[model samples]
Target: METFVCAGCGRIYLENSQRCGHCGGDLEERPASGRGIVYSFSSVHMGARGMPTPYLLALVELEEGGRILARLADNDEGEPSIGDKVVFSGLSDTGPVFRLF
Candidate 1:
């Protein structure tokens, strides 16, 4: 199962689990309303712990109000920019990630 961190309160959640463990904040499977903007990003080239090289990581701001740091989808092209619109897809087995639409 996948897991996620609460943007509202920094609580961790299992995929099958609902709500924030620490704050009881409502947890949606995807970014609320399928809308968000890229807040920041980075390209990893080395020493990525358990991950492969050349991965794109980003912090995204949800339209409903919150920020989540996630990996960008593999199919994405070009560098993601601040304020670039994004949509939530499924979680990566290694981490949570969002795809650019």
Candidate 2:
């Protein structure tokens, strides 16, 4: 996924605002490695905005040093745990999607 980095403070952002919020520096766009660990997650039984029910939402702590909220890909086996390795699968209609590594 595309991420923005602050030239002055090295802060990373998923949204590109053309300027950094921290140090008023220029933002540079970069590709993420798509590798991260599951920091936290929840199973949503109530769907919204056309999303299906019983989906997993997670906060992934990226190896590149930032966190992203993404949906976990459908897995029939089971749910993921905290600190489990995950990789970016792709973008869904909702947002970025991740899967267990």
Candidate 3:
């Protein structure tokens, strides 16, 4: 995944920015490892337009540092849990999608 890092404060951001919103630091664009642990998640039975129902949404803590909210790929095995390892599967209409690593 693409992220912007604050050169001054060492903060990472999912969105690109010329400067850090936190400390007015210069932002550098870089690629992320796309590996992380599921920090938190929720099962959504009701989804938005064009989105299928009964899907998993999670807050993942990247190994490099920083968190991202992404959609969990549909798994035949079972649902994901907190601390479960996940890897970037691909992008979607909404945003990034992650699967069990």
Full candidate order by lDDT, most accurate first:
3, 2, 1
Q: Give all candidates' CA lDDT scores.
A: 0.71, 0.87, 0.87
- Encode model 1's per-residue lDDT on 4-68: one tens digit a residue: 55657765443745768777776655424646789998888984578778888888887766677
**Best model number under TM-score:** 3
Off by over 4 Å in 1: 1-31
lDDT of 3 by residue, 1-101 (tens): 77788999887776776989999999998888888999999999988888878889999888888887899998987987899999988878877889997
* Model 2 TM-score, all chains together: 0.75
Residue 53 in model 3: lDDT = 89
Error of 1 at 84 (Å): 0.4
Indicate the residue-level lDDT of 50 in model 1.
85
Q: What is the lDDT of candidate 3?
A: 0.87
Write down the TM-score of every candidate. Answer: 0.69, 0.75, 0.76
